[model samples]
Target: MPNNSLNYHNCKCNIDVMHLQSQDIPLVARLYKRSFQNHFLGHMGHKFLTLFISEFVNSDANSGYVAKYRNEVIGFVLATTSDNPFREFYRDNFMTLVYLTISRFFKDSFIRSHITKRLGHVHVALKALFSFSVRVRDSREKQEICLSRQPRLLALAVDRSYRGLGVANELTAEFCREMKELGFKKVGLSALPWNQRAISFYIKDGWEKEEASETSISFSRLL
Candidate 1:
């Protein structure tokens, strides 16, 4: 069962922070799209986003939480004590995702370009075998698959209308508490290098900067 604990009065109405239920996926996915509008994942559309977010909720390695006011989900956070969330998502949904990607590729020019770029990165041999007009998936999965049990905050999102009212703070605090209570020694997360707000937020919350690359900056906090 999901945790139905924690409530905040930072706003006039009580904001309840609890474990995410199955019914909350659509709302959370909507929030994710709104929160990451300029990102590649956001362009995947609602149905894809629905199935993507549902993987986090359904996986035993993942934990999800939501903040609500008057029973409306206004924010959500997803974490994992292991790295199997994405692996499992693609494993179970590959064919379906490929169909969706093919449909989107023909309909959306941006998706077509993105898939084209992905195709460019494939090996010459693999490309020959998969020589199709357009590639179906945008991401190339690594051939070597190894699972890790490191606790990491996967994603956090809040409704635009509900920001700055302590909703994000409560969600982060609760997520950390849940990880600690589960015997995790530490947890980490990464934000895109250009997302200054997210980098600042993690730093403000006492997550020490760990490492960085062209794409992302990593932060960690000891439990």
Candidate 2:
């Protein structure tokens, strides 16, 4: 039911999707927490979320778009042109993210359990960070292949109050347009199978379901 009348050529649309900026991170972070309460990143606290979102502004590998309706940030979409956005963020902000993660883990039992459950991922990330230089050439080779095939959509969310108003559609279109402008021929994303609303929206918005595994349903769209 999302409205798809984004007039990128003019100012006639109901909401405007603008390139995300530093000042937009705070609002976008709060929206992320509200929208993703069940996700591990949501449990990482507001300060952590703020720092994480700052990467979208501060890093070159990752970028995002924010939607505004009458000056309020109603939604946002995040996308990465390269494969190692998380690794890049971890490499750049290691000590800070470590401090934040440890602080949250001790203070919140939920995070402790979550972290414990994902220790294998932590090990791989740590290994990747330490071996970055040794593997950069090979990693970049694979990244080039992946980048040429499809840049991934990292996250997309809309303000619940503004659903079905074309904000998600416009934000998605902006993401695709930006990626295509970046020389990518396709854009890809995934959704939790239980998130029927999001899955339906992606399909209705023109993404083709490409794969379905236990954890997520992947979708891709050509420019």
Candidate 3:
């Protein structure tokens, strides 16, 4: 159980939830990497991870929030109400996208490790690439045709030390509240099927599971 008493930093205060700032990106990125180290995004280098989070912060369609305890960011969430976040991101940051693409192909050590592990099999790389492409397309189609234009939570991360402190709950509640104020009727999020803990958390937080595929489970809540 997370300690609810906010008595850190030698002061009596409550966790402060606020709009995420540019200065907080690095800390949030580091926390994200630590929290999801087994996920694909986690294997990405720090530079790429920073750029990834920057996209959300810089995008007009996206919004983010951070939870501060004693003035230090302990958790953060990023979301977008855009119908097609990936397409919008690519359109808005073409050059950065190109750079990242090229960098991944030639410079990413994680990619190299996978290639090496697969015994330099081109087919393995090709298969992974094709699978990723298909998933991306399917997600976009689902959002466009089956889902409403409500905010979709892209990423939510809390520092290990901050887990069980209600930081995640607070960040999510804030995200949904902001979405509602922005004229959205509901909000949604997706989690890996294997992430039972996260799924349970969302369910307990008032989100209902809407759909599940082999790769992910989708959840939503009416605002």
Candidate 4:
């Protein structure tokens, strides 16, 4: 368990949460990659974070929050809209969107060509067509899997050095307050089931689990 005695006023730590700018993207991603290294070791790599820094940092500036102390970023909260919250964001983030589309196109093209060349006679045209339809439906389903009512708090991490301090609570509370002000009725976050400490923290702060999957538990708070 984390130390419970640390308080913002008496800790002599300067905690300030603010919106991160484009220049801060690299530092933020670096900090996040370091803080979450252990948790995401087998799941993702540093280059993925580095390459997607722009998409993560620029996803939803108003909903993203970062905590700094002594001029260094100590923690961050990254979020994305449920389903293209604003049409304008689609255009603004067109570069990343296009990148995703192009990658998908090439990936599908390569897979189709490989299958056609290798199993040309084994798999009939009807079977290949059925397989292609299944793949398309699965891809679309994955893309549409979003919270219906609340925006997701996709990632949140605190530097190990600052964990015990009330920074996490402060950042989370600020996120909830901001979402409430923006007319959202609730906010959601997910964590691995093994992280009992995080689960307890969320429950202590009034977040209740609305869903549970094999690897994660989704928590939400009514705003």
TM-score of each: 0.78, 0.84, 0.73, 0.63
Error of 4 at 104 (Å): 18
Question: Model 3 TM-score?
Answer: 0.73
Better of 3 and 4 by lDDT: 3
Model 2, residue 117: distance off in Å is 3.9
| lDDT (Cα, 0-100) at 201 in candidate 1 | 75
RMSD of each: 8.6, 4.5, 7.5, 10.7
Worst 10 residues of 1 by lDDT: 139-148
- Candidate 1: what lDDT? 0.73
lDDT by residue (tens digit), candidate 3, 36-75: 8776667666776787777667566678788887778788
Q: Give the best candidate by TM-score.
A: 2
**139 Cα displacement, candidate 1 (Å):** 34
**Clashes by residue pair, model 3:** 2-164
- Sort by TM-score, best first: 2, 1, 3, 4
Model 4 compared with the native: what TM-score?
A: 0.63
**Judged by lDDT relative to the true structure, which candidate is superior, 2 or 4?**
2
Computed on alpha carbons, the lDDT of every model, listed in order, comes to: 0.73, 0.80, 0.73, 0.62
Q: What is the lDDT of residue 184 in candidate 3?
A: 71
